[model samples]
Target: MTEKALTIITQREDLPQLFGKRIENQAAIEEIITKIETESRSITFDIETKEGQATCRSLAAKIASAKSTLDKAGKARKDEYTVTADLIQVDRNLVKQRLQLLQDEVRQPLTELEQREKQRQAQHETKLAALGYLDVQDHDRIGSKFIKERIAFLENTVIDDSWEEYKSQALETKDNALRILRPEFERVKQREYEQAELARLRAEQVQREQQEREERIAQEATAKANADAERQAQQIAQESERKEREAKEREARLIAEKESAELRAKQQVIDAAKRERDAIEAERLEVERLEANRQANKKHRDAIFIQAKDDLMANGIDEETAKQVIKLIHVSKVSNVTIKF
Candidate 1:
């Protein structure tokens, strides 16, 4: 498929004119645009080199100059048409303004009458709204007296010729407002009575509370006085008992000190006598032990000597010679010999 060439070309063959004047440079402008479009196809630059960068700037300046020339040509061609349109608009506005003034002059009387009628209707609406002002409110501040006055005012108000066509509506609105306010008056009275009763109860409650508080204060004062008296008696008793106990303790301590001193003296004497008897008994026991040891030694030596004499007689030796030999051994006069008992 063949791709379309991106180029500027004038397709219309109609005569070039703006605001009944010939576009003298229309063909020249088309020729310039085509030249620029053709030149744009050849535009090339490599920013890495100075010459290429200069070529890029030169091509951009040429494109900008071509756009400026085309813009000036278009503005010059449209300026005449714009001035003609402005003249037409000014003539049309003048004609419309003159016709409007004529029409207003013709309708002045009827307009004034209509405006007065509108004002009268607005006034009637306002007055009718005022008659129905007793509509139920979420937070009603109207008291019973105010409600009664409003009801009486509504009942006495005569809907007459002054109300014009709204007379019946005004009378109905007054009746309805009275009907609502009359019942509201009774409710407001009940609420007021309840509030008064509540105030009365609160006053009585405050008085009773004050009396009870005073009684409690008096009872507390009496309790404090009795407690003070009892505390004083207890303090006195404690003080007296403390003094008596301290006196008894002092007397008892003195008597105990005297008895302790006497007992100490007696113990010292007893300890000394006991020590003296122990020393005498120890000396007597030592003497008895030495005498018993000496007697035992002599008895053992006599038995040994008798056995030696008997043994020598059995061996055919005479007793007198054995006796002499045993006496010599006992005295250790025999060499390298001993008699063991």
Candidate 2:
């Protein structure tokens, strides 16, 4: 008996009879691969010849092509087969063992790093709390806000040298706070004393002004009273002077009336004496005139009588007889008339 050979090449319609079992699209894939092998034969070369370097490049390209086909075949095989529960469990256990081995390698070191970080944070907090407490106790020496800001700046330093630098900076801030504020206390106290003295002097000035105002008001009241009294005295003196002048005028008028009456009585007596002297002179002149006329008449009568007597004597009549006739009939009278017989 002779052995028959296996053939991979088949037609698409007879792939199930050639394999003696039912397969999925095997005959179609065989037909496509047979066409590629036949058409790609022109790319082959002899390794020992000059063109043999191209054979290395061709071998690399064939390897890449084979890797891509193997990946596709793996995906297709996974799709065609069903995974059992036991197989999935076995794969999960293998992944868990690898993860546990990696965690164990770093576990102790990670715990130590976490504990160290917690201790560093706690020590930094304790130092900051102590700084705040010192400022609250004596605010003049240490300022809380100043120290806190300095410490915060120090905390953000480089991570490799964080602890030692932060500690050194926090201690330096506390020392500087005490040095700056120690010398400012005396100046503030002296300023307060000067302000108190100025307030006292201003109060004294206001009291003196009030006293002077009261004295000026009193002096003005006294001056007004004196002026009113002087005006009243002047009015009384004027009234007295007017009454004295009127009394002197009345006395002078009475003395002038008495002198006028005495002059009128003396004039009446002198006029009566002049009238008596004129009457006596007129009576004496009348008596002298009457005596002179009587003497002349007597002389004339005597002469006429003597002449008549002489004529009688001469006519021879007796003188004694004629005398007797003259006596009887007054011859002087008869002769002027001639005697009639």
Model 1 misplacement above 4 A: 1-99, 135-142, 145-149, 152-158, 216-341
Q: lDDT per residue, candidate 2, 1-341, as tens digits?
A: 10010112212343222221224733223333334334343344454454554543443344334324433443333344434333323323322343233223323334455578688888876665444323222343334344445455444433234546466655555445434323223333354567678878965765565456545544544454444444544544565477867545543543353344334333333343334334544554565577666756655655555566677878887867765665555545554555322
The lowest-lDDT stretch of 10 consecutive residues in candidate 2 is: 1-10
lDDT of 2: 0.44
Q: Of the candidates shown, which would achieve the greatest lDDT relative to the real structure? A: 1
Q: Report the C-alpha lDDT of model 1 over 1-341, residue by residue, as the tens digit.
A: 00022122222222123212324623333443444455454555564466755554555444444344344434444564675554333433432343344334433444565688899999999989889745465214557887887777777778899999999999888888877777778888898999999989976875676556555655654565556555654655565576977656655654565456445545554555455546655765787799888878877887788888899989999967988999899899999999998
**Candidate 1 vs. truth: CA RMSD?**
56.1
What's the true lDDT of residue 112 in model 1?
A: 60
User: In model 2, how large is the Cα lDDT of residue 164?
Assistant: 61
Q: After aligning candidate 2 to the native by TM-score, how far in Å is the CA of 333 from where it should be?
A: 99
